[model samples]
Target: MLGIFVLAPILIGTIAYIIRDTWAKPLLFLFQFSYVAFAFSQFLSVKANGPIIWNTGGYTDGLALSLFADSLSIFMVLMTSFIYLAFLIFAVNADYFHSKFYFMFLVLEGLIMGLFLSSDLFNIFVFSEVSTVVVSILIMLNKEKQAIYDGMIYFFVNVIGSSFLLFGAGMIYRTFGLLDIRAVSAAMPMLEEPQAMILPYAMMIVTVSNKTAVMPLFSWLPKAHGTPSAPPVISAVLSGLYIKSGVYLFIRFNQMFAPVIDMQSFFFWVGFFTSVMGVIMALGQRDIKLFLAYSTVSQVGLIVVGLSMGSNVAYWGAVYHIFNHALFKSTLFLTSGLIEKEYKTRNIHEIRGLFRRMPWVGAATAFAVLGITGAPFFNGSISKYMIANGTKDAGITLLLNIINLGTILSYVKYSAMLFGKSREEQPGKPERIAAATAFVLGVISLFTGLFGEFLTEFFFGIELQVDTAEYIKKSLVYVFMLVAGVAFYKGLLKRDRILERIGTTELTFNGIITVMTGYFITILVFLSSVL
Candidate 1:
């Protein structure tokens, strides 16, 4: 069953391509729905039973190619399968919803599922490399000049990053003579010196960090996700879901190294700095896609912080945040596409009167904004509240607030487009399928938040009791931050010369590579010093 989850999509996608778009349409609709059902059933099975492990080629557990579905990974598989269905629904009426596009899209889904489920290290590398190729193709699917350039940068940079994973996986294999992650993790404790693992850890993390879009290694994210020519669904998937794969792997790798290595403190601080940098960059973006892209960087940073906080509650909080981020961020990106079409522009300032011109789009976008800003009774608030409860340190709590404030401030600029007199008339109700899909996602964002406590338990099997008084207190803080955000945006941030200049600042490809190299070395040095 676990192997089928990974392979069926790839097979079906190929069949869809061979049969062409005319037949492919219904085929995909049926397959995608079934895929979601299958994934959900698997999720229930994993919840009822413990972990499920399948070793392919009929080999032994640690010796054969393996697929391991634990509570964590099963949830990821379910999320990807379900969300891809939403993306498919969003794309059904789109111009690019042809045979070729669906082929790549479903193929990408299969590879991502592979990444989530595979227990073999080499298989993970293969999946990562293939997915990078698939994503580059999607980025340049239109073949526009700028799209081509962006895709080329994405392809080459990610390939280089993937190389680090290959090296790391090889080292692990060489060390333990086992390719399965579970096997190596069990073997790690037997090593006399953990120092031998440092080089491998550094190599693999550089790749994961790059994929997660952390500081110094995040320049490529905007180029790929914020590309002007890519389809909105592409951007949504890349930002909302694909990025979380890295976070998933980071958790896995950390667990694998838990016996011999622990560097949560260092990464916690790195995540903090990355969050701040992402905020500064996001605040400067004029393009909605770029702004959302940068905000993803910030949110991912915050998730990393939660993960690295060395608390069980915070780890689960970060995990929950991944799901919430996937919901709200995907909605934002999908709605942005509608906003762009209606306004005939992507400029944040040029677009106006979202609520007035297109109520559904505007409302949906607003819901997402509320969630992303951690407004009370939203999914983001629930996840963030969990993260906050993970620590008792006043300074850490204050820093988390600072990050949330930055989020609010950037979205203040985003929300400006939601209201004001419209310069152009709205289209025939914002393309019903697109509008409806995004609106539902936005609704889900709110719905999840309203029942976040129950949903987290249902999904993660962890009952994290929330403190009502503290949550009420936090809600008050959110209200204050929202007001402050608006005041700051009105008082000083609008059309500021410094901010405009900052928005325009971008690193070249060479510069990104250099930063990545430096990041890799820093991880190596930091781990060496700490361990």
Candidate 2:
């Protein structure tokens, strides 16, 4: 299954490369639609009782090439295909459309499919590296000096993360003498020593954090995400599906190491800190793109907290939010891209009264902002309710309720920049491709939220109650958050304070400190067990 899906895009690109003249564009479009059709078929076939496993090639004792399609994998597959379709449309209409660009895009599409479907640990490492390298090529396509700098930072941070991933995979293989994820998970209890499990678990956390841009490891993400030249879809995929690859591994391994590790406390604290830090940084941003980039970091922290709860509801929350965040966040970024292209500036202060100029884009941005902030009749509300319920059940102390408030506060800042009250009109035209994608996804978000229960059950194979009264209660909390955010912004406006002024030098210092801290902490634990 994985090989077929992964190979499809590569095959198209290779064929396109060969033809290069008459048929390349047609072929690219054909392959894009074909993959989406195939993905939807796979989704329909998957049952919640168990996953569908396909092992086309034999495995060496220490390496396996296999694929599995479960509810989770199906959702990711669908997302990759849908997002790729939008990117393809953008490519067709882009001012500069090169064959090389299409090739890179197709290769990334295939690699992501492989990453999501692979059932082997070593295979995850292989495909993840492929995705990273190919996406780096897209970043360089920005044709700006800052793009290269951002790409370099992206390369440096990801290499550090990849090292951790490989080390952890090696540790697991060394301990169990197997490379397949299902086998390692099943055999985890057979290992007699607790330290063997703890070592790999901690390494896995570092690796996952590096990819997902969790606090302390997220220095590269803002730079990479804010790079001016990359397309909005690329930014969306980078922040959305690609980052979740690490989170997927964490979820898989968390189940295996549940007995040896206390993931709840670790995720809660890291998530709390990241959430606060991300929003604070976003509030101080002059560039709206950077604001959205940091917002991705903060929202990812919320997803992590939900995943760490380790309950069925929390699991549902994490998974569902992954979908919600992808659609809403992408809509926001694409809308921002359109705004920047029209006004010829990324500064929010310079672009005031945009709502009157581009009413359609403004409306789209409003929908996305409300959706991500967990407003009622939106997808965010559904998943957030589940997380709140699970948090109470998990007894996670400190900031459970506070985190919910922060979600609303952060979006309040977002709204001010995106849809401020001043309605000044400017004469201009909108980018057709960008606006189309934004509007389509915005409508999809509203549909998802209105039928939120149906979508949840369809994906997870479990039906949950729709608590109307509790939902109303949650709305009140959001109202409070909005009020607080307005107050904070008013204060900042009056005082002219710096909110996101972590100098590049400061970020570099923090990155160094974080990487070293991760290394020494792992070693200390390993030595403690040995001594």
> Which candidate leads in TM-score?
1
Q: Show where candidate 1 strays beyond 4 Å.
A: 425-428
Give candidate 2 misplaced runs (Cα > 4 Å): 58-63, 393-398, 418-424, 492-495, 502-506, 513-531
RMSD of each: 1.0, 2.8
lDDT of 1 by residue, 13-78 (tens): 999999884788899989999999999999999999999998778899999999999999999999
| lDDT (Cα, tens digit) per residue for candidate 2, span 1-531 | 656888889888888877888688888888889889988888888853467777765654325567877888878888879877876775476654667878887888888888778877778888877777887777878678988878877776676677777888899888888778777777866767776666677776676677777776777888878788887667766775677777776676676666555567667677778877777677677787888888888888888888877678877987888888888888888788788877778877676655677777877888888888888888888888777778554446346566656666666656665554443455456877667778888877888889888888888875878788888877887787778867966676423555545422236735654764675485457546543
After TM-score superposition, the amount by which residue 314's alpha carbon in candidate 1 deviates from its true location, in angstroms, is 0.8
What's model 2's TM-score?
0.92
TM per candidate: 0.99, 0.92
Error of 2 at 389 (Å): 1.3
lDDT of each: 0.91, 0.75
lDDT of 1 at 165: 91
